[model samples]
Target chain A: LVDALTDRELTRISCGSAFREHFGAPYTVVHRRDLHGALLEACRKREEITLHTSKELASFGETAGRVLARFADGSEYEGAAMIGADGLRSRVREIIIGDGTPRPIGHVSYRGVVPLDQVKDRSHFDDMVIWIGPNLHFVQYRLRGGTVMNNVATVASERFERGERRDYGGPDELDEVFSHTTPHVREMLGYVGKDKNWVLHDREPRSGWTRGNVTLLGDAAHPTVQYLAQGACMAIEDAVVLSGKLKEAGGEINAALLAYEKERYLRTARVTITSRIFGDIIHCRGGARDLRNHLLAQRTPETFWEVDWLYRGIKA
Target chain B: LVDALTDRELTRISCGSAFREHFGAPYTVVHRRDLHGALLEACRKREEITLHTSKELASFGETAGRVLARFADGSEYEGAAMIGADGLRSRVREIIIGDGTPRPIGHVSYRGVVPLDQVKDRSHFDDMVIWIGPNLHFVQYRLRGGTVMNNVATVASERFERGERRDYGGPDELDEVFSHTTPHVREMLGYVGKDKNWVLHDREPRSGWTRGNVTLLGDAAHPTVQYLAQGACMAIEDAVVLSGKLKEAGGEINAALLAYEKERYLRTARVTITSRIFGDIIHCRGGARDLRNHLLAQRTPETFWEVDWLYRGIKA
Candidate 1:
């Protein structure tokens, strides 16, 4: 990581070493589409699992022994149990929890990918670099076997601060926010896609993930902001734990779902809250920003004490 | 520091090394009365200073060149400038800023000092220990050259949570809050004074400390909660910097005050906000608490990087 204004190196850690030391695996970064395709291929090979597409869930209802899911096309499916693995804005969560829309957290992100040879600057190309500044940060990393460079620039939306939600995070706002950054960071902003932007939103974590034979999973269960880059990892962890609980339940679906919810609730909620706090720390202005820079600059790159609980995964 | 429930050691640092290495002085703990007396004696020795007693400030006003202060006893004094070193409830601040009372952040503390031999248990007497638990913490340290022990117990008030502020933090609440803590921590709670308790308050940091010939200082400028134990320290820092600015400005009082305010505003504001954040960290519950404990346990006691910006004092 580097300070976007002064270009001072804050701290650096070897992701490979951090993962290898804790989990006995090298830290690997892959594109989301590639990972999704791989998972889909693996599931297609399974004999009992069937994949369905173009079926938008409208709502779900559960009885003591079974679940019924209704789709937007006036079709219905009955199953022994239902798992809502839908992403954010899951109809399952809306029906069960009754909370409205996810809260827009006032941050706007522009992201894009380009071939490595097309990039003019190579200073931070070999490593994942985050240039942090007041109310703004730029992240850069290599993807697709190091052939493509992905760039993301996120800034606190002035429009959102002024209480205007729609038509915010535009290309003009992106340029205006990055205009004051260092020359290197400013030049890199050219790589970010201006046509589209992500307005980040997250739900305040709640506990009732399981009701009867129906349960929520992944982003539907606990949608979090992307500050920690752990939202997808958390969903994967949820799947592992939930599958283990199901296998151990001896055909009792409700008991297994409750046990899974009990184990996963606190861990995911901490991630959701901690991610928001991390955003505040990185995007803080004035005195708080100065304090953050001073403290972060003093940290040793090799020390992993602060992140041990996170990277070590859940305790058995 | 230790976890109150399981009696697990978190992390420790030598105060002597921390202060000596950073500030070229030993970390010294003294009673508030003794410190106040020493400051009063030093002021008394100065020929330019006069001490007054039993005088309550009613209001103050200032012209471009002069400041006039009025006391509730029907007396008025005029001077070239005014400094509101009048602490948390300064009338000078009331006249200048008109911001109302400080905000009570939902915590209550009871503190008292007793002779060293009054307590039966002495396992943690030699060290300044803080037993951190969910929404509550107990602190103990030796004072007055180790002849007496100062005990402070702080807990998040249920009454405050229920929106009934008055008559809260009573002795009964104290007993009920510490009931679930370990026996050692519970026993130490007996030493806390039951007659009165302090409801913690701190202001959201603001920047307008100076207005013309009059300015606020100390707690009046940036009152803070006691979580970081830096309230008095920030005040002393303000005094030092203000004096330096005045001496540098020669006869320009307004210029000196403005410069002093500029220099001290960000530093003191950081302290005020950081203290509140520290309160949340120590009082965190459930998953966040678990994460804190796990991370804290992995830290080597001698690593002072996190506090280098704080304990090292301000830059020249």
Candidate 2:
């Protein structure tokens, strides 16, 4: 995957070099926006798909066994079923589920990419380095074909509760949070510009996604924190599995949607929960941190391949 | 309350006459549709309200500190806040909360009114009698100023699950369920026609409702089982308390909504849970049914008035 994503100068790092065969695919780097744009373009090329821009949902209901979606301008569209892929603050999810809000996990993340020219040294360009500590972690990865390095710093926020928004406090505050770290880590923080931080929100696993003729997909169905970087991947998987289920069900749209839900629910839930646990392990304090590091050092090729369950698809 | 509602011939009943002073307000009967229409007219008269029909939610979002509602026709309406009172399959509830379908408790109810003249005798014309048996219960009440008697028969169904529509099996199935019940009860069940049966669906208590600038009200927020008869009453109380809180919040819409939810959550949840318990107690079988009957027979006027928790409201 690393060779496929970018064949730029590779970083020989402590983690990847230590367990190259076990890792199966070397960690690849890609810009988030570029990946999103590529997916959008692929979707646009599909013959059956017509992408509508700036179209919003007024309300939705069922009439004569068809899903009737009414827009604000008094126009309506009818279909056998409707798939809600409306991201985290999903309106279609709201229509089917009623009201449940995403919970804040008291963590805020600052993300930005620094141009390679600005860095004093670029020797770590191929290394995806994760600096773990008490209630905080910093990850630096190559992006833009290794010309720029992406830096993400996650810290435990003090004031924000489960439902409250985080108040961003500029780059100086970012510097203060990582003051106890090594000098090189402190210098990495200097590269992050203001206006790049955001509060991370997620939800517990839910049993429901399909209701009658309406169903949910992607973040509208299950949204998780960015700890695993599998949010977009899971959504893409949902689209594929859902389409396959719809075709498999013959002509019953609701039944097909339900089948899709049954197939994808546990897999997505596992990803959501595993990502949380993975973050907790990396952001440990005191004795737990030593234990986590010890476990990482002890990773055999066989044990590391345990993540094959994640990289590979679930059993039929 | 009875005199205020209508000037019809009233039933002098055992329960009401037995504890006249303790009951507080005399029970009044009004057609559900008539009462709903009255409420609608009152809402229509309010100058602050504008009634829009056929407007459905296409999608919704938050922008510039406002809740943006987009209809299916591609038009948008922005508000400082939104209150979702869309009832049962509420579109607004779906937007604020994701998908959690209501659970069915395996019961179907057949309801209809029989004119007093249809019966050979009208001796129990004003009396409200509940005949309970194993897995079934029959309720007979006077309606339309004692000119008619309404019979409701609730029976357990084997075929349907929660979120599935109830199949109306006509009077023969109703007769089969109540064959072992009392002769009078069996005769009363004959009065209900084939078309009035409905499946009862409800949800367990949920935690999330208010999110940012949007919230839910009444059935859209907390939909309870009909066993309590408090569904409409609780919805009415929600409206009153929500408006009061909104006024009290001064200018903070989210705070007012949070306050309204806080005041109502526990009270409504209690009603929802208690109603389910009451239904279970009423629909007991074998030894449980005998025990329940014995307890009902032993009830004194004081014991009957013990429903002050329900009638007078829970202690503060």
Candidate 3:
């Protein structure tokens, strides 16, 4: 991590070795397409599994021994159980919890992918680099086995803060927000895609994800902001825990779902809450930013105490 | 409010007239003893009300028709329903919700009340004055019709931050913490009691404060840190709502308790959550504090837009 304004290098940890020592595996980052393809290949090997697409869920209900799901295309399916892995705007979650829409946290992110050969400074691009300034941060990392570079630039939107959500966080605003940063950071921002941006939203953590024979999984259960870079990681962890609970339940669907939710409630909530706090720490302005930088700079790179609770996976 | 380190006037809010115009009554500060006495006198005028002292609760349970509360002294009382107005360490809540002790947020406060004649700077004492610095704040205001001044000094304890809970916020540490502040803030700190200090704690807001014929109220339901100065105010609001619900229940205790909890859940939870966020905002350091001061200083004295949602009392 680097302070963008001062060009000062903040603390860096050897995450690969640290994660290997802690969890017997190195911390890994993968492209979404590759991960999704691998998981789909594994599912295709199973005789009982089938795949469907473009089937947006409309509603779901449970009877005495089975669950029924209705889709927007006017189709219905009955199954012994249901798992709502349908992400942030899940209709199943709305039917179960009904907490309304996720909250917009006044941040917008722009991302792009470029070939590694297009990079100007390969030395700085060798490892993951983050440039953090007041209310904005730019991230660079290699993906697809170092063949491509992933770039993400995020900023707290001034227009969003002023209560105009639409047309905010555009390419113009992105350039304006990062104009005060180092010229190197500004140059890097040029690689980011200007055609599209993502508005970040997160839901407050709540407990009741499982009801009857139906339950939620992954982002459907706990959607978090991208600050901690743990949204996909949490979803993967949820899959592992849910699978383990299913095996332990011996075909008892409701019990397995309930156990999964019970095990995941506090952990995922911690990630969601901590990610917001971490965002504030990094995007802080004025005196708080100085204190954050000062405190973070004094830490030893190899000291992984702060992340022990997070990186140390829960016992399934 | 003043920045103690820079001695800069950050913002001045005319809360007196603002609250008066908004609520038809001015925002009033009173000594705890006087407030308690007035409440006790009012309760004494009611024939059906009885006050008990030093009777610590051990546990409570509900039967088909009655709720039974057992005291630590082995005495038991049976009533139609039990309202756990018991405060922060509430045993009633322990039995009902079972969430553990309140979380310590690493803040310590010392308070003292002195006669008006003891104060050297009466001009600053006339209005509620708050001096904020990085990681610490000192507050002063006249109480009991200006016969006395209530002084409070609070700091984010270094020892507490370093994981030493005990012997952390003593007078010596207090002095060391405020040594960098302006002379006036330091002198005001001299009036704060040295012997006893308070460590702050609050709980994450959760639903389900009511079950059966039993329910929670006040800090027992949703304890908050003092940053917003709304702990007592929220508790009072709970009482009003609870009483109204009981009268509307028309002899149905379970209905009444559930109704009260439903009404107070979101509001009180909001206060608890916002208080923590507000604490972070006020106790900010580095660039965040600078931004806070700059933004707040731009506000008009009579602009109460930020507090409209809070100070606007709910309709019963």
Q: Which of the numbered candidates is closest to the native, going by highest TM-score?
A: 1
Tens-place lDDT per residue, model 2, B83-143, is 8887777788776776566767777788888787886545455666566665677777777
User: What's the distance in Å from true for residue B78, model 2?
Assistant: 80
Which 10 consecutive residues of model 2 chain B have the lowest summed lDDT?
B1-10
**lDDT over C-alpha atoms for residue B79 of model 3:** 93
lDDT-best of 2 and 3: 3
- lDDT over C-alpha atoms for residue A47 of model 3: 92
lDDT of each: 0.84, 0.69, 0.84
Instruction: Tell me model 2's lDDT, rounded to 2 decimals.
Output: 0.69
Native contacts retained by candidate 1: 0.19
Candidate 1 Cα errors over 4 Å, as ranges: A1-35, A45-223, A236-273, A282-316, B16-23, B158-170
Off by over 4 Å in 3: A16-19, B1-316
Candidate 2 lDDT, A125-150, residue by residue in tens = 66776676656677788887778888
TM-score chain B for all models.
0.96, 0.84, 0.96
- The residue-by-residue lDDT of candidate 3 on B1-316, one tens digit each, is 8898988888887867666877676777878888889899999999999888899888777789698989989999999988888899888889888999998988889999999889887758568888888778998998888899899999887787766868777778788879999888888888989888998998877768888998998999989998879988888899999899989989988988888887887677767767888877777774356557756877988888777768887885
Per-residue CA lDDT of model 1 for B1-316, tens digit only, reads 8888888888887676754876666667778988899999999999999888888989877886888889999999899888888888777788888789988988999998989889788988788899988778999999988999999999887787667768776778778878878999998998988788888898867777788888988999999999878878888888888889888999899999999988887777778887888888887776577767766877787677766767888754
lDDT string, candidate 1, A1-316, tens digits? 8888888888887666654876666666789988898999999999998888999998777776978899999999999998888888887888877788998989999998999998998988678888988779999999988999999999888787777878877788878877888999998998988888888999877778888888899899999999888888999999999889999997999999999998888778878888989888877776677667766777777677766657778754
Candidate 1, residue B267: lDDT: 72
Clash totals for all candidate models:
0, 31, 14
lDDT of 1: 0.84
- Docking quality of model 2: it rates as incorrect
